[model samples]
Structures are given as C-alpha cells and as structure tokens.
Target: METRSLRDDEVMKRKLLIIGWDGASFIALDGLIERGCLPTLARLRANGFSAPLNSTLPPVSAPAWTSFITGKNPGKHGIFQFYEVNPWSPKALGRGQRTHMAVPGVVVNSRSIGEAKFWELMSAAGLRLALINLPMTYPPAPINGLMITGMLTPPGARQFTYPPELAEALPPYEIDLNPREKDFSSPDAQFLRRIRDVLAKRTRVALELFRRERWDCFVVIFTETDRLQHRYWHIVDPRCDASEWAHIEADVVDVYRQLDRALAELVRLAGDEYDVLVLSDHGFGPAAIKRLNFSALAERLQLFVSTGGWERNVRRAFNRISSSKRRIYKYLTPLVPERFLHRAEAGLKTLARRGVKAKLIKLHDYIGGVWINTTEHPGGVIEPGPPYEALRTQLMNRLAAVRDPATGKPIIIDVRRREDVYHGPYTTAAPDIIFILDDEYGIETGGRSSELILRIPQKNQGTHRREGILIMSGRAVRPNVQMARANPTAPGIEDVTATMLYLADVPLPEDLDGRVIEEALDEDFLRRRPIRRCSSSRRPSPDVASEVWESAEEEAEIRERLRELGYLE
Candidate 1:
C-alpha cells in the first residue's frame, strides 16, 4: 500500500452522491429494515459502512444541515437557529423606557451562512457539482454547475434555482410539502396525500436531474422524512395508543416504503461508478412527555423580572383572554362557525404581540436558546460582565435541578454556558446559556401557558434526537464496517462534508471543525490517494454582516411555515 497523489484524471473521474433524509434515525430505520420494509437501505447497510451521525447541539434541522454542508459548528456557520433575537429594534425602547419584549429579528436565509459550503469549495477546486433541495440554500447563489434551493424558500418565490434559467428546464418542483396541511391533533389523510404527492414530485425532479446533469458530485435532500416523523411519530411509536391510529399506520409506513423505492432508483441511476452516501441532519424520537416553559420557569425562579407597567397589565389581560379562548375552542370548535374562530384567533395574536414586553431573559423558541437581556438592549436590566455570568450560572443550576413530576427524574441533561459550547467571532450573538433537555421533555418558549411543565398530547409525539443515521457504500468504501466500532467518537453531521470532499479528491479546508472519516474508506483507496489540505484563511470572516429578507411579507410567510411545522407557536 504505497501512498501516492491522486492524478488529475482520477480526480476528474471521481463521482459522489449524497442523499440526505432529514431527521432519519436508526431507531426507526432498523426496525423497518428488519421488517424488510426498507430493502434498499438494508442492502446498503449490509454491503457498506453504517454509523450514527451526531447532530448539532440543539439537534434542529436549520443548524444541523448547515453544519453538514459547511463542516463547521453553528457558531462558525453563524446560523444558530431559524431565527435570532433582534436587540436593536426601536420596539425595545418602548416609549423611552425599558420593556420586556422578545423580538425575533429575521428568518435565516442562505446569506446567513458564514462559511463557504463544500460545493463552493469543490467548485473552486474545479469539480462539477449538482446541489438539489439542500436546506438553508434559499436565495440560490451562482456555483460551478447547477443549484436548486430547498427549505425556507418563500412560497411563490420565482428564483429558487441558480443560473435563473434552470428552473425552466426542470419539472415543476416544490421546495417542501405545504406546511399548512399539517394537523397533528387528528389523523389527516389530506396531509398524508400531500406528502406523497410532494415526495413523488421531488423524486421525479431528483431522478431527472441525476440523469441529465454531468457532474463529479451530486447532492439532494428529502425533507419529507423529518416532516412526517414530526407529525406522525405516534403512528409508529409502540408506546402510543394503536387503536386510534392503527388504520393509518400502514399508510404511514407506505410513505417510508415509497421513499425506499425512490432511494433505490436514485442509487440505480448513480451506477457503480459513483460513491453513494446517505445521511440525515438529525435523528427522530418520541416527542417529549412534557413541555418545559422556559419563560415560566425563569419567572418562577425570579431570574426573569417583568417591568411592571401598563403594558404588563395589558399582557396579563391578554393571557387571561387567550386562556379562556383555548378552553372555549377545546369544547366549542365543533359547534362554532369556522370564520368566527379564525378572526378570534387572529385578534388574540395581535393582542399578544402588542401587549407583551421583554423580560430579563428571552426564550428563543425556534433555536431553543435562552438569551440574557444585557445592557445592549433597550431595557437592559442586567449589566454585562459579572452580573451576566452570575445570572447564567444561577439559571443553569435551577434548570438542571428541575425534575419530571410523574417520574421524579431529572428533566434537563445538560446546561452549558455559550462559551463552553461555541467558538468563533459570532459566539456573542448566541444565547448566553444553552441547555439540553431530556428526550422525554421538550422546551416551550412562547409563554402560552403559565405552568412550568405541561403534559404533551399523543398527537405531537415526535421530535429530533442527536443521533442520525449515516450509510456509506461504494467502490471506495470499506465493507461491513460500523463507525462506532471503528472509532470511539461517532461521525457527526459536519464530518459528512469533509468526507465527501476527501472522496472527491479536494483538499480539506483548514478552518473546518470536521475531519475526514478515514475509517469508512477502503485501505487501498487511502493508500493510493493521500489526504490533502489547503488554507481557508481567505474565506470570509464569520462576523461578516448577513443579509435579511427584503420585505416584511416574505418574512411573515416564512414565519407561518415554521409555525405550521411546529417550530414556532
């Protein structure tokens, strides 16, 4: 096994295909595979290396997928979540006085990503590329080959493809399943239908592109997996009552089966010449048994102080009305007029937004981060330095102490200071304190209820986990290898990009947090093509200003989509 440099012909001939199944986990996949339901994946696992890919800190899609493409952590990528706190808003001033209001600044877009994606680096290295339906890729940028943006593309956005004319060449495609059709409270046949339809359209586009595109590397992601698991986990989870959802169980499984077929088709099209890698941004699990209202808990602990004023009174009134409305809707929705109910809901939302002010600590719902209101904001109650550190420490301790009432088990698994987990110039933009909740619990930041802990309903019984699935099989990969057995630390989402770059014979970027997963590669392949490195110091700094949505309507549309997907309340 003599080491040698990859020749130009070898580099040009290397082909890699990445298929991302957002929120896929081995817990579900293994069970399905054992049942022969996902034969393609089963075959892939049997023939090649498989491992659990660790997700980002919060285990959410936005950051995890971004990390996957950039081989960087959330701090380095500058996309902590779907949204971030806007401390500079004039609304924070509130008539020249400090008010306790949380203002979500903007929906994160492609421009928000701080690092160059692997495709960009590969393109610069003279590799032909095809990127399809990759999330956080909205506002598509020019690349070496072609690109089709994925999640967060505003509904009706015309510029979802690069070169502007590629959209015309492709079949009618959707960025994602319409979020509005999701209804977790009941079995939704319509939702299932829409997902299947979307899946079909996506598969068609992917297959068509793969057939026509001439490229060294092609990457495409299917987000419907994450969407289905989020809403229909109850159908698959054995712990949930089967009687109510048993009828739809087969239909749900069929969705996965259809996905399996689609995956097989894609691989068949890729041929033996291409190295195939299938992965997920994060894993899926039973939704938490209880919800932790961070804002309520902070208030209970007195770490979050309300600036008592007329606005506070108004907020209190709004809460009472909102609570009463929920109670009424719970009992009267069947009897009430639909239009009336919709108007009432709209009115309440307006009231809630206008009446509420910021507290000392803001709970960012989408990102699952807690920001300390320091002197930088309008109503900064806590001073920067010692006070900030003390508050964070105290909050972390209190959160760690919380226990589930029914089980008497700790609810929080870990609480970390921002600095402990994140590094880079954008670190300060992150929450001062980041906490990880037990899988049995989910955090609720909307302050919809005063209770610190509320039981989760069965309908909403799935959420993200840290361990996603990764399967690598190709001529260049080792057979029958398990990543965990090969290495103590499992491969992470970030490592996927680095591994792909290495396989494509591109030099690894020096600034990347992820390293090539060498154990999964064939001994001969590694010996013949030694790894290479290049300085990425010329890349843009993470602190470079990010672009925001040009119009309020676009921002609103994205917010609604996130809310429908259960990312926001």
Candidate 2:
C-alpha cells in the first residue's frame, strides 16, 4: 500500500480553535453591534463572515450541546433531555438536578449517556485536544489530551482529566467567584466584580493552556451568555420596566463585551498559530410562558381525585394531624428542588404508605406530570400512555382553552406530540407530552399549597427564545456566509466536528449525522475536499457515554468536587 502526502501548499493548515457561546441571539447581536457595544465582534464580522447559527428543535441545552460536540441528533446521541433516562429500567433522574435519592454508587452506576462525543473522534486522529467547561461533560475520562468537564460535573471530585504531567502544569482549580451564589444573584456591584475576576482568570488560564502545549486544535465553550440570559432576559425586553431591569441589562451587555474582548485577545495570541472558529450551541429568548406547573395543571384537570370534595380542605386536615403525629418523618421527607415550597412530603414510598393508613391525598407538585403506578385510581386519569391519541386530543383541547385572564387571548402556542417535537427511535422516553406556551404567556407556581387554575398574572419575565449566532473566519472559510432568513441556519451542534476536521485535514466518521458545512469552507486552501459520510442513514443504535472510572475512590473524588462547585450535589 502506498500513502501519498500533500505538498506544503496543498495541505491545509492543521490548527483550529473554536469558541462557543451558548444562547447568543442574532437579534441581540445586531442591536449591540449597532450600539458599538461589541466592537471586536463587529470588527470580526466586517473582515470575516458571521450569521445566525440555527440550533436543533426544542433548543434546550443538554441535547443541543451534545449535538454540537457529536454532530448527531438526540436520536443518534440518545441524550433527549436534561436527564439521561435509563431505558432499560425506565427510570429518569430529575432534570438539570444531578442527584437521585438513591445511594451514590447506585446513581453513578445507573445513570448513563447515549453516545461517543467529539473528543473521542479527535482522539482517534491522535491530535492534542483540550475541552473546557462544556455542559454535561463531567465524569471526565481519559482522552488523547486534557479534559475539564463542565455541567453536571460532581462536586469535590477532580472534574478535569489530563496527562499526569499536564495536570500538574495547569493552574489549580479554585471556584472563580468567592461566593459562587453571587454568580446567580442580581447583576450588582458584587456580581460585576465577580464577572471581571472570572474573565481575567479565564484569560490567564486560556493563555497558559495555549502556551504550555503545542495543541493541534483547541476548543473552548463559554456558558456565560446562557447564564446571563437566564438571570436577565426580562431586563433586556423593551416591554418590561427599564427601572427594574436596568442594571441587569447593562450587566448582560458587559458580559458579552468582556467575552468579545477576550476573543480578540485569543485571536491576537493564536494569530499565526491556529485557525479560529467561533460558534454557539443555541440562542436564548424569553420563554413563551412565565411558568406552568404541569403537576398543578394535571391536578386542576381532576387527574388526581380526593374522596373528599376539596383537595385543599382534605390536605389541610391531613397535614394538621400528620404534622402533629409524624413531625420527624415530615422534616426528614425530601422536598422538591424548587426554592420555596408549600409542603414537604415523604418520598414515593412514604406517600404510598400514607395513602393506605391516613387519607388518600391526590396531588403532584412537580413538572412533566407524576408517574402513576396503577390504572385503578383517579390518579391514573392523567397517565400519558396506552390511548396516546385520546390523551393527545384532550391535551390539545386543554392547551387551546388556556387564555390570559386579563386579555382572554389564547396563551398556548402549540401542543406537539412527543414524536413530532422529538426526533428519535426512543420516543417513549422523549417528553411523554410537550406544551408550547404562547409568545408571552408566562406561568408561575411557587410556595403555594392550593392548586388553582393556570393563568398569567403578575409579570414574571424571562424566556429561552429560538435563535442563536454563528461566525466562521479562517484562510479556508468563505466570507459572507448567508444564514437562513426565516430561522437561524440549521447547523446541527454535531456538524461543527466535521467542519473543524475538514479545515484540519482530518477524516470524519461515516456514522456522524452532520456534514462539514461546506458553505462556510475557505475555498482557496484545500488539497482535497473531505469525503463526507453519515454515521448512519437510519438512526444508529444508541451508544451511551462510557462508565470508565478507575476506582470507587476516584469517582468519589470527582463527585465531591462537582457538589462543591454546585455543578452537582
């Protein structure tokens, strides 16, 4: 066998760096660029090409980010939601929340991911890679190079994995914000100070990583954009009071500007050393609804029945007696993750025990509805199975009936079947049902014992809109790539992997879902175009992330660190 190598000019540059911003909207960027708030990004756009990067349907984070790395859909990757469902067991961990009531070992062993990620592909090419704080990338495994896991990384554990030598070379991990909670509080002076500190430290760490290693390609994802939007979307909306959100709006702008400046610095450093690619997983916008406790909705629909007329009355009496008799059990009962709570009830077993001895209390306070074990009781009325068609019809009717109390306008946008909203063979675990609220229909439920009609009342402003931004600029990239006008261009999160490989002269896996976005390629600098292949035309069987911890002690260490960092607890 003979292998032919390309001449220096024929072979494209091998180095590439990707910086990802989560939930960055083109609408926001257009306004910011006009206001001169993002001079660096504006300058990059002028010389380079940038467009709205379309994200996947349902545009939530976990699946979106997973797709970004793997260049595959949820069907291919099998991470449909925040929780990684155990299809075999038919059990689901809480969404966004990491821990289960089970013992640490059980949860660790039970929870699993659906597929191989970008780093795996990168490793096969024998290229040095560094991943920093990518969401849901914790439980760091050995890769070709360094890995610092991001979201869902367990606390007190060593979230970063690297060559022993590289681990020693990097700076020590310290929680950037002294009081990490300040990161979530209002954008006050304290918040600004913390932001500045983190940005500076981040720059230092990034530069150090770059200088320390002759990395072939470096990919870094920053989630500050998503976090800022989560805390300040209301402030950015013109319809909301400026006074209430004024500070938050300014803070959001500052965060972007800081990121822009950081990017500028990175480009300056990697100017000749690497090709640069900036991207995002998805954009953010105000959610259509403020809040909708599906649990509350199901209860109001009389899905759960009380032998007595009013559930509220029955609960009040039951609570009085139970509190007096079983105060210890009540205190020990695990509460829902919501900040404020109406009642702290026991876990499922305790509840069932109470159902038999005391009174039949029928209620659920969580979203996505409650799991019903039996078909005999009134509680099974809301069960989303068997006659899925009938349930779908009823759900649509109820959604249509939802209206604003003030304006009497319909608030439900669309109720999509799980099959339609989600794309995959594992539709069973995909949302049993999904409700899309109207553009501004905000739902709120908090700290209330009584179940009431779902309606929009006081303004609770914040949402995750469906638009994000993408930019590509390199010797091989064509300037002025046109984005789809109607929506952000459908650059699946996984496509970036193939795109980067195309730029760097690496082969792509045939099984991947996304193509090397050829439209963004730099035309003049290629020896040969990449031979694209799909991971599979048919959805590939799910290949979950590996559970390859060296030992129980190692796992414990990582889990503890994650809990301390608040990534997991």
Q: After superposition, how far is residue 264 of candidate 1 from its true place, in Å?
A: 1.1
Return the top candidate by TM-score: 1
The clash number for model 1 is 5
The TM-scores of all predictions, comma-separated, are 0.85, 0.73
Candidate 2's C-alpha runs over 4 A off are 1-5, 8-10, 85-111, 172-183, 234-241, 244-252, 287-290, 293-296, 299-302, 305-386, 442-462, 482-489, 523-528, 534-569
Q: Write the per-residue lDDT of candidate 1 for residues 437-464, one digit (tens) a residue.
A: 7766666654445567876554465877
lDDT of each: 0.75, 0.55
- Candidate 2 lDDT over residue span 1-569, tens digit each: 12343464235546787887777776567677888988877776666666666566556566678777667776656664444333223232222111111111212211244555666766776878877767766566677778666654544445345554554566754323342443354436665666666666666677777676778778777766665565566555445455866645666688878988888877787776576777777765664434454345544443433344454565666667555734544564465343223344422212322121001111111112112222333223334356545655665576567665566776666655656655555455444455555555443433132333344433223445555677777667777665653443566566777787666666666766677777676665543554534343333443343454456575655455433432232
In angstroms, how far off is 484's CA in candidate 2?
6.3
Clashes of 2: 40
After superposition, the stretches of candidate 1 with alpha carbons farther than 4 Å from their true spots are: 1-13, 85-103, 183-187, 238-243, 304-368, 405-407, 446-450, 456-459, 483-488, 542-546
